[model samples]
Target: MQYRWGSAWGGQRLLGTENIEVAIINRGRPLRSVVLEIRGRSPNGLPPVRMFQEIEELPRNREVRFELASYEMPDEIEELNLSIVSSTAVE
Candidate 1:
């Protein structure tokens, strides 16, 4: 899994927000579902914000992309952490 951050736009004007793009490559086997947890800190030094997303029916040796929620661009998120919350295999 790999993650990247970029500015989000609604149209011509900037939405003044940022969003994350995740790429997941299934190697071992097919999966029925996968839950991912994203955690990051704010620029203001406040508590971290976390979000979760679930992807279903992923096939083996396939790559999938996911777009996460948009957040304030100036949040100055220092680091991003991605974890596999849960996964189910396809039998």
Candidate 2:
């Protein structure tokens, strides 16, 4: 299945350190094997890892809340990367 990351349905930015909730919206056939991981880079470095989680099958076009992370405002996360390794991939 294909994976999409966002704060909501199709959001790219999660302003400030305010408990950001991310969802992995899936669209495609049922996935047999799915491995996904997200890493964020900030000026202060990894901040205690408030939340981190993953899932296997997410309904087509539906969003599955991956996890939540609390970040401080003006933190300006340098990078937010997601890598999904599965039977089907679109990247």
Candidate 3:
């Protein structure tokens, strides 16, 4: 899986104060279930903010847009890490 953060309209701006827009692409095999984790780190030395989303199903080479609700995102996140925590492939 691959992900990118940006507004739906354009540019690299965040969606809103309490929401994040992410575009995810499934480049590998079809999946029955998957858990995605996103970590946002700020430059001010605060603890990293973590968010998770569970995708029920993902087809190979398909793109999915997810608007994750974030209640404690820092105003200036310097770095973001997206990872696939777990996944189950379709048999």
Candidate 2's TM-score reads 0.49
By summed lDDT, the worst window of 10 consecutive residues in model 3 runs over: 7-16
* Model 3 agreement with the true structure over 1-91: per-residue lDDT tens digits: 7878765455665634545678888898998688888888877788888888888988899888877555557665667788889989887
Error of 2 at 81 (Å): 1.6
For residue 67, model 1's alpha carbon misses the true position, in angstroms, by: 1.4
Best by TM-score: 3
Best by lDDT: 3
Off by over 4 Å in 1: 1-16, 72-74
How many angstroms is residue 13 displaced in model 2 relative to the true structure, after the best TM-score fit?
7.8
Whose TM-score is higher: candidate 1's or candidate 3's? Answer: 3
Candidate 2: count the clashes.
2
> lDDT tens digits, residues 1-91, model 1?
4444443333322442556555667776787778888787766787786878788866787777777656433355666687878888887
- Local distance difference test, candidate 2: 0.52
lDDT of 2 at 89: 41
Model 3 regions lying over 4 Å from their true place: 14-18
lDDT of 3 at 30: 92
Q: How much is the lDDT of residue 26 in candidate 2?
A: 61
What TM-score, to 2 decimals, does candidate 3 have? Answer: 0.78
How many collisions between residues are there in candidate 3? 0
